[model samples]
Target: MENAENLLHKGVIEGEEGALNQFYYGYEANDPPEKQLSPPLKSKITGISLKRGQRVRLETPGGGGFGKSSERPLEKLNYDLEQGYVTETKDD
Candidate 1:
Protein backbone atom coordinates (compact mmCIF):
# COMPACT_ATOMS: atom_id res chain seq x y z
CA MET A 1 0.00 0.00 0.00
CA GLU A 2 3.05 2.18 0.61
CA ASN A 3 1.07 5.14 1.85
CA ALA A 4 3.46 5.21 4.76
CA GLU A 5 2.26 8.51 6.12
CA ASN A 6 -0.28 6.52 8.05
CA LEU A 7 -2.50 6.92 5.06
CA LEU A 8 -6.21 6.46 5.56
CA HIS A 9 -5.52 7.52 9.12
CA LYS A 10 -4.10 4.31 10.49
CA GLY A 11 -5.21 4.17 14.12
CA VAL A 12 -5.27 7.86 14.13
CA ILE A 13 -4.22 10.04 16.98
CA GLU A 14 -3.28 12.89 14.82
CA GLY A 15 -2.60 9.99 12.51
CA GLU A 16 -0.28 8.50 15.11
CA GLU A 17 1.58 11.73 15.42
CA GLY A 18 4.15 12.39 12.73
CA ALA A 19 3.90 8.80 11.74
CA LEU A 20 6.45 7.31 9.38
CA ASN A 21 4.77 4.03 8.72
CA GLN A 22 2.17 1.85 10.39
CA PHE A 23 0.65 -0.31 7.70
CA TYR A 24 -1.70 -3.20 8.30
CA TYR A 25 -2.70 -5.86 5.81
CA GLY A 26 -2.07 -9.55 6.28
CA TYR A 27 -2.68 -13.11 5.05
CA GLU A 28 -2.45 -16.90 5.11
CA ALA A 29 -5.16 -19.19 3.83
CA ASN A 30 -7.41 -22.26 3.97
CA ASP A 31 -10.28 -23.22 6.10
CA PRO A 32 -11.10 -24.97 2.88
CA PRO A 33 -8.47 -23.63 0.43
CA GLU A 34 -9.81 -22.15 -2.74
CA LYS A 35 -6.59 -20.09 -2.76
CA GLN A 36 -7.18 -16.35 -2.61
CA LEU A 37 -5.91 -13.73 -0.21
CA SER A 38 -3.54 -10.95 -1.10
CA PRO A 39 -3.63 -7.20 -0.81
CA PRO A 40 -1.29 -4.47 0.27
CA LEU A 41 2.47 -4.93 0.12
CA LYS A 42 2.18 -8.15 -1.78
CA SER A 43 4.43 -8.32 -4.79
CA LYS A 44 5.44 -11.95 -5.15
CA ILE A 45 4.27 -13.63 -2.01
CA THR A 46 3.49 -17.30 -1.78
CA GLY A 47 3.98 -19.06 1.50
CA ILE A 48 1.45 -21.21 3.25
CA SER A 49 2.60 -24.06 5.36
CA LEU A 50 0.08 -25.00 7.95
CA LYS A 51 -1.27 -28.27 9.04
CA ARG A 52 -2.17 -29.78 12.39
CA GLY A 53 -5.82 -29.22 12.89
CA GLN A 54 -5.51 -26.31 10.52
CA ARG A 55 -7.87 -23.39 10.81
CA VAL A 56 -6.85 -19.83 10.20
CA ARG A 57 -8.44 -16.48 9.63
CA LEU A 58 -7.10 -13.02 10.17
CA GLU A 59 -9.03 -10.33 8.36
CA THR A 60 -8.86 -6.73 9.35
CA PRO A 61 -9.97 -3.63 7.53
CA GLY A 62 -11.43 -0.59 9.20
CA GLY A 63 -9.40 2.53 9.48
CA GLY A 64 -10.44 5.41 7.33
CA GLY A 65 -12.19 8.32 8.94
CA PHE A 66 -11.14 11.76 7.95
CA GLY A 67 -13.91 13.83 9.45
CA LYS A 68 -16.73 13.99 11.93
CA SER A 69 -14.80 13.06 14.97
CA SER A 70 -16.24 16.37 15.94
CA GLU A 71 -14.36 17.66 12.98
CA ARG A 72 -10.94 17.42 14.53
CA PRO A 73 -8.08 19.77 15.30
CA LEU A 74 -8.32 21.26 18.67
CA GLU A 75 -4.63 20.56 18.47
CA LYS A 76 -5.70 17.16 17.29
CA LEU A 77 -8.31 16.97 19.96
CA ASN A 78 -5.78 17.69 22.64
CA TYR A 79 -3.62 14.99 21.16
CA ASP A 80 -6.47 12.61 21.55
CA LEU A 81 -6.79 13.35 25.19
CA GLU A 82 -3.12 13.23 26.13
CA GLN A 83 -2.60 10.01 24.22
CA GLY A 84 -5.11 7.73 25.78
CA TYR A 85 -6.22 7.64 22.17
CA VAL A 86 -9.67 8.84 23.20
CA THR A 87 -11.98 8.77 26.14
CA GLU A 88 -14.28 10.91 28.22
CA THR A 89 -17.78 10.02 27.42
CA LYS A 90 -21.03 10.74 29.22
CA ASP A 91 -21.67 12.50 26.01
CA ASP A 92 -18.40 14.23 26.58
Candidate 2:
Protein backbone atom coordinates (compact mmCIF):
# COMPACT_ATOMS: atom_id res chain seq x y z
CA MET A 1 0.00 0.00 0.00
CA GLU A 2 1.07 3.54 -0.73
CA ASN A 3 -0.04 7.14 -1.03
CA ALA A 4 -2.43 7.09 1.92
CA GLU A 5 -2.83 10.60 3.21
CA ASN A 6 -5.31 12.49 5.29
CA LEU A 7 -4.95 16.15 6.05
CA LEU A 8 -7.29 16.91 8.94
CA HIS A 9 -8.56 13.49 9.99
CA LYS A 10 -7.19 10.01 9.39
CA GLY A 11 -8.89 7.57 7.08
CA VAL A 12 -8.97 4.25 8.99
CA ILE A 13 -5.63 3.33 10.50
CA GLU A 14 -5.13 5.10 13.83
CA GLY A 15 -2.17 7.37 14.53
CA GLU A 16 -0.88 6.97 10.98
CA GLU A 17 -0.30 10.09 8.91
CA GLY A 18 0.63 10.52 5.24
CA ALA A 19 1.34 7.80 2.72
CA LEU A 20 2.30 4.51 4.38
CA ASN A 21 1.92 0.75 4.08
CA GLN A 22 0.85 -1.64 6.79
CA PHE A 23 1.26 -5.41 6.79
CA TYR A 24 0.13 -8.10 9.18
CA TYR A 25 0.53 -11.87 9.29
CA GLY A 26 -0.87 -14.50 11.63
CA TYR A 27 -2.58 -17.84 11.78
CA GLU A 28 -6.28 -18.24 11.74
CA ALA A 29 -8.22 -18.07 15.04
CA ASN A 30 -5.70 -15.58 16.43
CA ASP A 31 -7.27 -12.69 18.23
CA PRO A 32 -5.06 -10.18 16.45
CA PRO A 33 -2.24 -10.26 13.93
CA GLU A 34 1.12 -8.72 14.60
CA LYS A 35 2.12 -5.58 12.68
CA GLN A 36 5.14 -5.88 10.40
CA LEU A 37 7.27 -2.85 9.69
CA SER A 38 9.72 -2.65 6.81
CA PRO A 39 8.36 -5.74 5.20
CA PRO A 40 9.65 -6.50 1.76
CA LEU A 41 7.58 -5.13 -1.10
CA LYS A 42 8.00 -8.44 -2.83
CA SER A 43 9.16 -11.82 -1.65
CA LYS A 44 9.78 -15.29 -2.98
CA ILE A 45 9.37 -18.33 -0.73
CA THR A 46 10.56 -21.79 -1.65
CA GLY A 47 10.29 -25.13 0.05
CA ILE A 48 8.17 -23.63 2.79
CA SER A 49 5.43 -25.86 4.04
CA LEU A 50 2.44 -24.43 5.76
CA LYS A 51 -0.43 -25.90 7.63
CA ARG A 52 -3.99 -24.97 7.01
CA GLY A 53 -5.60 -21.80 8.37
CA GLN A 54 -2.73 -19.42 7.73
CA ARG A 55 -3.63 -15.90 6.74
CA VAL A 56 -2.11 -12.58 5.90
CA ARG A 57 -3.65 -9.13 6.01
CA LEU A 58 -2.55 -6.18 3.95
CA GLU A 59 -3.78 -2.60 4.25
CA THR A 60 -3.24 -0.44 1.22
CA PRO A 61 -2.83 3.29 1.34
CA GLY A 62 -5.79 5.43 0.35
CA GLY A 63 -7.01 9.01 0.28
CA GLY A 64 -7.62 10.62 3.61
CA GLY A 65 -10.77 12.24 4.74
CA PHE A 66 -11.38 15.81 3.57
CA GLY A 67 -13.36 17.43 6.38
CA LYS A 68 -14.08 17.30 10.05
CA SER A 69 -16.65 14.91 11.42
CA SER A 70 -18.50 17.64 13.27
CA GLU A 71 -18.95 19.57 10.08
CA ARG A 72 -20.61 16.68 8.24
CA PRO A 73 -24.22 17.23 7.21
CA LEU A 74 -26.88 15.64 9.34
CA GLU A 75 -28.36 13.60 6.53
CA LYS A 76 -25.04 12.16 5.45
CA LEU A 77 -24.03 11.45 9.01
CA ASN A 78 -27.32 9.75 9.69
CA TYR A 79 -26.96 7.64 6.60
CA ASP A 80 -23.50 6.59 7.59
CA LEU A 81 -24.68 5.70 11.04
CA GLU A 82 -27.60 3.69 9.73
CA GLN A 83 -25.35 1.86 7.28
CA GLY A 84 -22.88 1.01 10.05
CA TYR A 85 -20.13 3.07 8.46
CA VAL A 86 -19.99 5.39 11.45
CA THR A 87 -21.10 4.86 14.98
CA GLU A 88 -23.00 7.27 17.18
CA THR A 89 -20.98 8.87 19.93
CA LYS A 90 -22.18 10.36 23.17
CA ASP A 91 -20.82 13.64 24.44
CA ASP A 92 -19.52 13.45 27.92
Candidate 3:
Protein backbone atom coordinates (compact mmCIF):
# COMPACT_ATOMS: atom_id res chain seq x y z
CA MET A 1 0.00 0.00 0.00
CA GLU A 2 1.07 3.55 -0.61
CA ASN A 3 0.74 6.76 1.41
CA ALA A 4 0.49 5.19 4.82
CA GLU A 5 0.59 7.75 7.65
CA ASN A 6 0.85 6.78 11.25
CA LEU A 7 -1.58 8.90 13.31
CA LEU A 8 -0.79 8.00 16.90
CA HIS A 9 1.70 6.65 19.37
CA LYS A 10 1.66 4.51 22.51
CA GLY A 11 -0.63 6.40 24.94
CA VAL A 12 0.52 9.81 23.79
CA ILE A 13 -0.12 11.58 20.49
CA GLU A 14 1.78 12.03 17.27
CA GLY A 15 1.77 12.29 13.49
CA GLU A 16 -1.17 13.61 11.51
CA GLU A 17 -4.58 13.92 13.06
CA GLY A 18 -6.70 11.50 11.05
CA ALA A 19 -7.20 7.95 9.96
CA LEU A 20 -4.40 5.70 8.77
CA ASN A 21 -4.52 3.03 6.11
CA GLN A 22 -2.87 -0.23 7.01
CA PHE A 23 -2.11 -2.93 4.47
CA TYR A 24 -1.94 -6.66 4.97
CA TYR A 25 -1.93 -9.98 3.13
CA GLY A 26 -4.96 -12.18 3.62
CA TYR A 27 -7.92 -13.87 1.97
CA GLU A 28 -11.47 -12.58 2.18
CA ALA A 29 -14.16 -15.09 3.01
CA ASN A 30 -16.16 -15.97 -0.05
CA ASP A 31 -19.82 -16.74 -0.38
CA PRO A 32 -21.40 -20.11 -1.08
CA PRO A 33 -22.11 -21.51 -4.52
CA GLU A 34 -25.49 -20.59 -5.95
CA LYS A 35 -26.29 -18.58 -2.85
CA GLN A 36 -27.50 -15.06 -3.20
CA LEU A 37 -25.61 -12.47 -1.20
CA SER A 38 -24.55 -8.91 -1.28
CA PRO A 39 -22.21 -8.08 -4.09
CA PRO A 40 -19.70 -6.57 -1.69
CA LEU A 41 -19.99 -9.36 0.84
CA LYS A 42 -16.69 -10.54 2.28
CA SER A 43 -17.73 -13.95 3.56
CA LYS A 44 -19.55 -16.80 1.83
CA ILE A 45 -21.05 -19.96 3.17
CA THR A 46 -17.98 -21.77 4.36
CA GLY A 47 -15.06 -19.98 2.78
CA ILE A 48 -13.52 -16.59 2.30
CA SER A 49 -12.54 -15.05 -0.98
CA LEU A 50 -8.82 -15.29 -1.46
CA LYS A 51 -7.09 -11.97 -1.79
CA ARG A 52 -3.90 -10.08 -0.98
CA GLY A 53 -2.74 -6.53 -0.52
CA GLN A 54 -5.88 -5.29 1.18
CA ARG A 55 -6.00 -2.17 3.36
CA VAL A 56 -7.83 -1.07 6.49
CA ARG A 57 -8.00 2.06 8.60
CA LEU A 58 -7.53 2.80 12.27
CA GLU A 59 -8.62 5.88 14.17
CA THR A 60 -9.11 7.16 17.67
CA PRO A 61 -12.55 7.02 19.20
CA GLY A 62 -14.46 10.27 19.90
CA GLY A 63 -11.79 12.11 17.99
CA GLY A 64 -9.38 11.58 20.85
CA GLY A 65 -7.13 8.81 22.15
CA PHE A 66 -4.03 8.09 24.16
CA GLY A 67 -0.87 7.77 22.14
CA LYS A 68 2.29 9.50 21.05
CA SER A 69 3.20 10.55 17.54
CA SER A 70 5.14 7.66 16.00
CA GLU A 71 5.06 4.91 13.41
CA ARG A 72 3.51 1.84 14.89
CA PRO A 73 2.28 -1.08 12.85
CA LEU A 74 -1.26 -2.34 13.17
CA GLU A 75 -1.59 -4.70 16.09
CA LYS A 76 -4.14 -6.85 14.33
CA LEU A 77 -7.08 -6.40 12.01
CA ASN A 78 -10.03 -8.33 10.60
CA TYR A 79 -11.74 -5.36 9.04
CA ASP A 80 -14.75 -5.63 6.77
CA LEU A 81 -14.42 -4.12 3.32
CA GLU A 82 -18.00 -2.93 3.33
CA GLN A 83 -18.86 -2.02 6.90
CA GLY A 84 -15.46 -0.83 8.05
CA TYR A 85 -15.85 -2.68 11.33
CA VAL A 86 -12.45 -3.95 12.38
CA THR A 87 -12.15 -7.09 14.40
CA GLU A 88 -9.00 -7.73 16.36
CA THR A 89 -6.89 -10.66 15.28
CA LYS A 90 -4.79 -12.91 17.47
CA ASP A 91 -1.93 -13.06 15.03
CA ASP A 92 1.22 -11.00 14.93
Candidate 4:
Protein backbone atom coordinates (compact mmCIF):
# COMPACT_ATOMS: atom_id res chain seq x y z
CA MET A 1 0.00 0.00 0.00
CA GLU A 2 2.74 2.43 0.97
CA ASN A 3 4.71 1.41 -2.08
CA ALA A 4 1.73 2.25 -4.31
CA GLU A 5 1.31 5.66 -2.69
CA ASN A 6 4.99 6.36 -3.15
CA LEU A 7 4.81 5.43 -6.82
CA LEU A 8 1.76 7.65 -7.37
CA HIS A 9 3.39 10.58 -5.57
CA LYS A 10 6.49 10.28 -7.71
CA GLY A 11 4.43 10.07 -10.90
CA VAL A 12 2.41 13.18 -10.08
CA ILE A 13 5.53 15.12 -9.06
CA GLU A 14 7.24 14.15 -12.33
CA GLY A 15 4.07 14.94 -14.40
CA GLU A 16 4.08 11.41 -15.84
CA GLU A 17 0.64 11.16 -17.44
CA GLY A 18 0.96 7.47 -18.23
CA ALA A 19 2.20 6.66 -14.77
CA LEU A 20 -0.74 8.54 -13.25
CA ASN A 21 -3.10 6.50 -15.41
CA GLN A 22 -1.51 3.31 -14.15
CA PHE A 23 -1.98 4.53 -10.59
CA TYR A 24 -5.79 4.55 -10.98
CA TYR A 25 -5.69 1.00 -12.31
CA GLY A 26 -3.53 0.04 -9.41
CA TYR A 27 -5.97 1.64 -6.95
CA GLU A 28 -8.92 -0.48 -8.15
CA ALA A 29 -6.74 -3.55 -8.52
CA ASN A 30 -5.71 -3.24 -4.91
CA ASP A 31 -9.14 -2.39 -3.45
CA PRO A 32 -9.89 -4.52 -0.42
CA PRO A 33 -12.09 -7.53 -1.06
CA GLU A 34 -14.82 -6.42 1.36
CA LYS A 35 -15.28 -2.88 0.07
CA GLN A 36 -16.74 -1.64 -3.22
CA LEU A 37 -16.31 1.79 -4.83
CA SER A 38 -19.22 3.69 -6.31
CA PRO A 39 -19.38 3.89 -10.08
CA PRO A 40 -19.73 7.68 -10.44
CA LEU A 41 -16.52 8.49 -8.60
CA LYS A 42 -14.61 5.97 -10.65
CA SER A 43 -16.06 7.38 -13.84
CA LYS A 44 -15.18 10.94 -12.80
CA ILE A 45 -11.65 9.95 -11.86
CA THR A 46 -11.31 8.33 -15.29
CA GLY A 47 -12.66 11.54 -16.92
CA ILE A 48 -16.04 10.14 -18.03
CA SER A 49 -18.09 12.67 -16.09
CA LEU A 50 -21.13 14.25 -17.67
CA LYS A 51 -20.20 17.32 -19.72
CA ARG A 52 -22.22 20.37 -20.74
CA GLY A 53 -21.19 22.71 -23.49
CA GLN A 54 -20.38 26.30 -22.62
CA ARG A 55 -19.86 29.37 -24.82
CA VAL A 56 -16.68 31.21 -23.90
CA ARG A 57 -15.86 34.68 -25.15
CA LEU A 58 -12.35 36.01 -25.01
CA GLU A 59 -11.93 39.17 -22.90
CA THR A 60 -8.97 41.01 -24.42
CA PRO A 61 -7.44 41.77 -27.79
CA GLY A 62 -3.83 41.62 -29.10
CA GLY A 63 -2.39 40.82 -25.69
CA GLY A 64 -0.28 37.81 -24.73
CA GLY A 65 0.13 36.95 -28.46
CA PHE A 66 -3.52 37.25 -29.48
CA GLY A 67 -5.03 38.87 -32.56
CA LYS A 68 -6.92 42.20 -32.50
CA SER A 69 -10.12 40.27 -33.21
CA SER A 70 -9.54 38.00 -30.20
CA GLU A 71 -11.71 39.86 -27.76
CA ARG A 72 -14.78 39.01 -25.71
CA PRO A 73 -18.22 39.13 -27.32
CA LEU A 74 -19.12 42.55 -25.95
CA GLU A 75 -15.49 43.65 -26.09
CA LYS A 76 -15.29 42.53 -29.68
CA LEU A 77 -18.27 44.63 -30.54
CA ASN A 78 -16.49 47.61 -29.02
CA TYR A 79 -13.42 46.73 -31.05
CA ASP A 80 -15.43 46.59 -34.24
CA LEU A 81 -17.00 49.96 -33.47
CA GLU A 82 -13.53 51.38 -32.78
CA GLN A 83 -12.34 49.91 -36.07
CA GLY A 84 -15.15 51.72 -37.91
CA TYR A 85 -17.34 48.65 -38.41
CA VAL A 86 -20.99 48.03 -37.47
CA THR A 87 -21.97 45.02 -35.38
CA GLU A 88 -25.04 43.93 -33.49
CA THR A 89 -24.76 43.41 -29.76
CA LYS A 90 -26.57 40.53 -28.11
CA ASP A 91 -28.72 41.17 -25.04
CA ASP A 92 -29.08 38.60 -22.30
Best by lDDT: 2
CA lDDT of every candidate: 0.46, 0.51, 0.34, 0.32
Alpha-carbon error at 56 in model 3, in Å? 9.7
TM-score of model 3 (CA atoms): 0.19
What's the TM-score of every candidate structure? 0.26, 0.43, 0.19, 0.16
14-56 per-residue lDDT for model 2 (tens digits): 3323334554554465544343222443333234333577666
TM-score order of candidates, top first: 2, 1, 3, 4
After TM-score superposition, the amount by which residue 10's alpha carbon in candidate 3 deviates from its true location, in angstroms, is 17
Runs with alpha carbons beyond 4 Å of true place in candidate 1: 1-44, 68-92
Say which prediction, candidate 1 or candidate 3, comes out ahead on TM-score.
Answer: 1
lDDT per residue for candidate 4 within 22-92, as digits (tens), equals 11122233456344323322212444332244221211112122223334477766877898553355333
Distance from true location, Cα of 71 in model 2, Å: 0.5
What lDDT does candidate 4 reach at residue 16? Answer: 22
Better by TM-score, candidate 4 or 2 = 2
